[model samples]
Target: MSEIPDAQPFTPVSDVGEFGLIDKMKAALADAADARDLVAGIGDDAAVYRVGAAGSDGPSRVHVITTDALVEGVHFDRTYVPLRALGWKAIAVNVSDVAAMNARPRFATVALGLPNNLSVEGAEALYTGMAQACERYGLAVVGGDVTASARLTLSVTVVGEAEERAVVYRRGAQPGDLLCVTGDLGSAAAGLRVLLAGKDRMTAGDGAADDPPQPDLTGFAYAVERQLMPQARLDRIEAWAEAGVRPSSLIDVSDGLASEAHHLSQAGTVGAVIDAGLLPVHVQTALAAQRFDERAEAFVLYGGEDYELLFTIPEAEASKLSPDTYAVVGQVVEPKEGVALRLPDGNRVPLEAAGFRHV
Candidate 1:
């Protein structure tokens, strides 16, 4: 008999990082799937497909699909993150991806990995929160699957639709284009810090047996609420449609400002220069950062889970947007410039992707 060779050593997924793993998968699967109707594939926020033949006017409308998974210890902690809030967050994260494509979320399919200890009522409470979010976003829960697991996990897939011309990708920004972001940043990360601190105190037996401790949320209500329940930027999409404005390139701030900025820069083969003074950090976020002896800008630049929309548009089309709701924070530049943050004192520093990494 011929001698058998030893099996090759297994490779660790962490060696490549999250996005790096995605790129490897993209290359490996390039020829495995049909590409006749595929519009956007693995590299973008969501996979988009052309629904039908092109109309007389132009190209056909497209469908957007995206999925995200939230694991117990990785994404949340039951000690501080309530069941209802956890459920809502699971759906909101997927919805944010749909909005990033400039499409309206229409349907969702949820899959739950229920543990043996979770009761019927506990599962029902989770569904209730999902229902509330579905109603608020005008989405429907079409179907799903339930399975047993050692730890709780939620996986949500959201489907959205949009006109071919309206769908935005993260690859169209040009040099001199203005960068804009919606609402504020950093509150979610600060809130998470506060929650974890509270959890640590409780674990150390901070209170009497009869008087279990609660996190002191006084004056940090806004930050705490933002962390528990994040809203997808569908409203911004609607407003853009009404104003006949479309971003050249767009993405959601789910992985923090610095990370998303690098995504856009690399996707478009350009560079992004964000002004530090222009970043819209919330007052509550600043106060929370102070309590922890951290800079608010650190939270703004590195804090994931903000779920705000960040996009770039031509300066000529800037007049279409309302200054009150959208803030121009930066501009696109040539790839040689790379991604950098312009400080208040006029010095520039490299902006690194130090945001949340799945691996």
Candidate 2:
């Protein structure tokens, strides 16, 4: 006698990857017909909502929200990461989104999935770091859920508010606008490489008999700090607002310049020209790239998690920005031109993202 087994459906996540899956699932979710309050959805940095009558003036008052999650083994390595830094990153990344919308973070809720290996002291350290970041960003932790899991997982949701007129989005750039960025690029990814380089070198017999092998993270401290505890560009956004330099389009550089630029250009129905020589590179990032037998330009174009601001402004408004802090990287062009990078040698080539993917 043979036994029959029930059939199970199978599909590979890699077949579609992150963006494709988002498009599919987004198509499946039906939009509300009479949803007047919804300002932005699915594709943007955050979901925007128009609250009641706060539009006492011309523009409506809006609230923006975003969520992010990090998992052990997939996003980070336990051998190198500290609990406090992990906690700060969990909240800082979300706050970066709120900043992108030209808003200030007001509240947050945390949901944690913990494994048995973590202790009460570890939990306290994590919260301590979260609290410090909340103070820095002028936000408060409202509520959350805690559950058991095989490894540590953290999810954070943030809420922020702004005037409708002040809220910047991905889809507003026009031709002739100058592309710009705050601070340097690619340091965080280089830092991760330095960290991994140490981890990959360790073996059971490599250290003294009594002591375990430890990564000597000296001279490369800049990269390590950028990777483990990068700060969102909150001050720059605020300064821009005060200086009356409203961006025609804006995005946070969580992914590299190329990927985020593609997102901006695609949404705006425009084209872009990323200038390779104009990219700001930290000294440590350059040295790290050389150590890894790679070029710093690749990191500047393809590295993710920099948390700097990528934005476009009219050539007229570009004059208001401080050049030392904001690097004018490129320009927006007609849609037919498509997205491309202008190399130092005067060659123009298509711009493509080489950032990470998880599915």
Candidate 3:
């Protein structure tokens, strides 16, 4: 064989503007495999899908719906996030919203805007991740739209169904209700710190000439995994219903516990007092935060993306809940008092709103 000339190294994606990148992405995914349930896919004003008729049990089953958007650079970093994780995250976040409403997610429509820099193979990898999430959650990607855009963007709308009288909302809490949440908080935030530090180390090229040991990432890995593939609390919601436990109010911790507590307080026209000592912080989360020189307590209070359910139950019925699945974090008080954090030392402090925001 003849000798071949060497080609120049590939440039990074940042060289191209956002819109130009999207155009390249569109061209790459031009031949997506056909999906039968997709009435529309990858190019339309909105995707359309068909849902089966309501069962004969009652009036047409009520549809529970929610939408969430993930933007490159804002919600995720293309460099560190594997394509599969990215796809899973896009769907998982939407599913969490549906679970927050105490509904079973059944269908989802994913709309994507691609930049030209991404290859068809890369897009397929992303779809593979999304498909895995759908299977895991018992949801179907019934339809979606694909289009060229300035940047990589994934917008997902999930449709769910719940019995007419079973859907929960955020505005129903009353005074004397017991506030609760599923799972521990702060792991995702701790994971983010580890990721950032790892990125910095890699960029700095501070490794030994021989072979430096890889950084310990166990704690961060769990946190990052939680952020990437958070499971919806649908199982717990169903169990609560079966046990005859109805929440007086409900909301999800898309934001941190502190912010969500304020949300429930404002919506229900009541104040809340959360015991700081009772806030759940996973061991991994605490360790990760310590490695990053961050306060573990602060992370639990204000670090977002836990996605656990925050709800209220009548004081009398709170005892019926299984402690393994839920924790009584606080109590509802009259509105004029405002939300507060009762300290371990028997002092109280005003609860400030702290959580993630796009802008």
After superposition, the stretches of candidate 3 with alpha carbons farther than 4 Å from their true spots are 1-60, 206-215
Off by over 4 Å in 1: 1-7, 53-59, 206-208
| Per-model TM values vs. the true structure | 0.95, 0.94, 0.81
User: For this target, which candidate reaches the highest TM-score against the unseen true structure?
Assistant: 1
Pairs clashing within candidate 2: none
Worst 10 residues of 2 by lDDT: 203-212
Ranking by lDDT: 1, 2, 3
Question: Which 10-residue window of candidate 3 scores lowest in summed lDDT?
Answer: 39-48
Tens digits of per-residue lDDT for model 3, 1-359: 97787988897766764434755765677577454433323321122332446355544345667778888988888767778888988887887777776777899999999989878888898899899989988899999899987778999999877665666677678889998999988887777777777777665666554554344575466787776667667778788887887787787887788888887886448999999888888888888877777898777788888888899889777777776989889899999778989999989898887576543
**Candidate 2 structure lDDT:** 0.86
